[model samples]
Target chain A: MIITRRTFVKAAAASGAALVLPGTAPGAPPAPVMRAVPSSGEMLPAVGLGTWITFNVGDDPVLRDECAEVIAAFFAAGGRMIDSSPMYGSSQPAIGYGLEKLGRPEALFSAEKVWTSSAADGPAQIEQSRRFWGVPRFDLVQVHNLVAWETHLETLFAMKADGRIRYVGITTSEGRRHDLFEQIMRAHPLDFVQFTYNVVDREAEERLLPLAAERGMAVIVNRPFRQGALTRQLQGETLPAWAAEIGAGTWAQFILKFILSHPSVTVAIPATTRVDHVRENVTAATGPLPDASMRDRMAAYVRDL
Target chain B: MSEWWTYRLEDFLLFSPRVYWRLFELNNAASWPLHLLTLAAGLAIVLLALRRPPGHGLWVAFILAALFAFVGWSFLWSRYAAINWAIAYVAPAFGLQALLLAIGGAARGSLAFDRRDIAGRLGLLIAVVGLVVYPLMPLLFGRPWSSAEVFGIAPDPTAIVALGVLLAASGGLVPLLFAIPLLWLLLSGLTLHAMGDSQAWLPLLAAAITVAALALRRIAR
Candidate 1:
């Protein structure tokens, strides 16, 4: 029986079954939700691993090994994209350590950034980041926080033209400079755009989200848990009764599902140091997402808290 | 683009409290047995300060200079820089403090201790805190004992001890010596505060006490 994504989503929604896509071995766990990149139609898992502060383990072999374990578990749970930046201190090296430890998984989707303030240094920083991840080329290279965006975007676009990187994009976080972020998105033909958006921080819903959808740019949501502050705040609070309808067993999933449920979001990168949390974050993409009404209710419930 | 004022202290902190403390633990592990000598050195400085021999002040300054140099190289540059890119820039300030201590010790032979003064007594107490109480902070905070930041090894306690010793001393250059250590205390205090650690106020409190002692000495004079 030929199984299409639409039919599978319909079957899962109707029967309330696990989201195990076709071609999986019998009895295997459900696969994570995958969304297509708007430019190339390349399907990427909706839940990616973020290495902002969590993976900046420095040169500590023990902590580096622990990060490798998180990566191992992240891949084991069907996660693909792993995002990091040079601005994140030793995070890139720690990711290199993890990739080397994991023997460089084939399913890896490496997303890196060129973060230097000097425009001339953009290509060199990209090369250094590529070496750090041990990947030949990044799937996406963003101009981090929109620093030196004009020159770096030109360099990134050139790299994309040369097939050095699969995608070119820009990012901003903490809701800083939304006007500038939107201006760049409007001006440039970006393949991806990353910014902060969570259940409570819904400011992106105003313009950026819609702009991304209108321009066919893939959206990678950062700070899905406000760097774990959101989950910590909601900890010990009972999960809403209707959360189960969307298969959100934990608040991590509830928040991630809310981000992923947004039609424009291509991925939500929630960082964690624990193997269990990585597994939990990946499983968030496996379950049925909240519909528009349920999404509103989830937001309202968290906002009320 | 000049909207730098919008950023908060928490925004600059890239690592969590867990990672920050782990750096001390790892530094302690990497520099074992040396901690014993550093601790002994700290005690020796305190004993020498108490004795106040004709030239003991120079000895105290020399010891503090060595400790500052060691922490600058070992902890700030070697270990903490791995996690915090900003520390690489701050490490040179530690070297500058060390140089000032050495130069001041050689040039004026000032920094003589007078336990009779209120500032001197408070300075000795602060030094003792840096040596004993600062290390015990891990235990109080429910962290592993291995992560205890030691004097002469960890930057925070080393700066505290240096500030304390500088406070106890009498010298024209003593105030100059206070600059780097006090700046470091402020930076680390801000860092800890950003991490939401309950003990965040310790360094800041230590700095404030040093400033108060300096004021008290000024008033007494």
Candidate 2:
């Protein structure tokens, strides 16, 4: 009953998930959804790739090759954003290796973070991130977990002004400092903000998501699967028949669709190392999105399980 | 505020299950043929213990020292240091264990090994398990040979071997040499369990056996 155009728009933004267009003939592959960046108005795929625990393959060529295939699969499925941080050991270089192997994917929307506290070290770290990612400039450079946010924000603002990075944002994955985060969000001129927000961990729904929408800041949702715990819990469970209406054939799509249905969310970065999982995650972008009532039903269904 | 305090052991791990398991596979790939050398050293120690060879304890001590140093430099420092920054600090602990083992062996001239006793028999069993049997654990857990953890090349079996060697020797210095390996077993066991690893209980089981064997030895004395 709470159907709205926002659902279709958010689902439409997920360009990589749908294999066929919404109005395509019965057998045609659906078009992936796309969302716009709030500040630059640049459209990005709703389903981005995260490289947190998944891409930290320190100096292992065999694993690096595996990650390369995952990247290839991601791009082939319409992924554009690849988020990483210096804190995830060797993840940046691993991404660099994968990109090199994949011939430097043109669609790569590189996002990294400045993690350390020392303001002087921020630029050098960003430079290292560039080298590790093998990029001339970054699309986004965020203050990781808001560590020394004031100091890093100034540096990030300068970098943005200098054309070193296209966007400046702050992130918090710890899920505790919402009060401080909201305060910063209210004050800072951030282009984006990332935090943990999944179907189960909906704490962001009350403040962060609403604030992001109100402030016109793009929201990148992390831990979309609660770090794989939700999948593990839902293992072997059957998808509801109603889910087919939204094109969610698998639980991956079900959960991802729930997140994508949110009006405030720009993208949900689910980190996966397996190529098949990448394909599954990308497919979540396609199909009909759940409306507000359906999202509530989805939440209730998951809770019952 | 109390969330940080409520965090479980698995909370701090920076890797997924697949990535964590892949580490072993990659580590095994990087440290090939060294498995043969470790196997040989483990056998030599078993033979030395069984035959009551002169300076058996010294030989076992040096072998353990080499294994500790190998694990320190190769596994912890070179490989694991990349993922777990804690390895950088922990690598020196292995180095310290190696040094202590070397000094203890040299100062004592030789360890007294008498298989005639219960302690000696139990010690030999523990050592042989580390050398010969431990590598087979991966097979039980449905892991491939590529991820098989072996002594000298892998920390789990290496620590178990060192603990067995320490328990077999008769000296006040044995306890000093036992400290690091004991701590490692507990740490590795808990970590593995937290990660939901199939062989999670092996290190802790080995540690428990080692303590019980040591206690039995004391009772017999």
| Reference-based TM-score of each model | 0.93, 0.87
> Per candidate, chain B TM-score?
0.96, 0.91
Span of ten consecutive residues with least summed lDDT in model 2 chain B: B108-117
Q: What DockQ does each candidate score versus the true complex, computed on alpha carbons? A: 0.66, 0.46
Range of the 10 consecutive residues with the lowest summed lDDT in candidate 1 chain B: B107-116
The parts of candidate 2 lying over 4 Å away from their true place are: A1-29, A117-120, B26-30, B49-54, B108-121, B170-172, B211-221
**Number of the top lDDT candidate:** 1
Q: How would you encode candidate 1's per-residue C-alpha lDDT over A1-305 as one tens digit per residue?
A: 22234533443343222223335567876788878787887888888999999998888888899999999999998999999999999999999999998899999999999998999999989999899899989999999998989999999999999999999999999788999999999999999999999888888878888788778888999999988888998997999888999999999999999888777788899999999999999999986887767777887899787
Q: lDDT, candidate 1, residue A12? A: 33
Best-fitting candidate, scored by DockQ:
1
- How far residue B134's Cα lies from its native spot in candidate 1, in Å, is 2.1
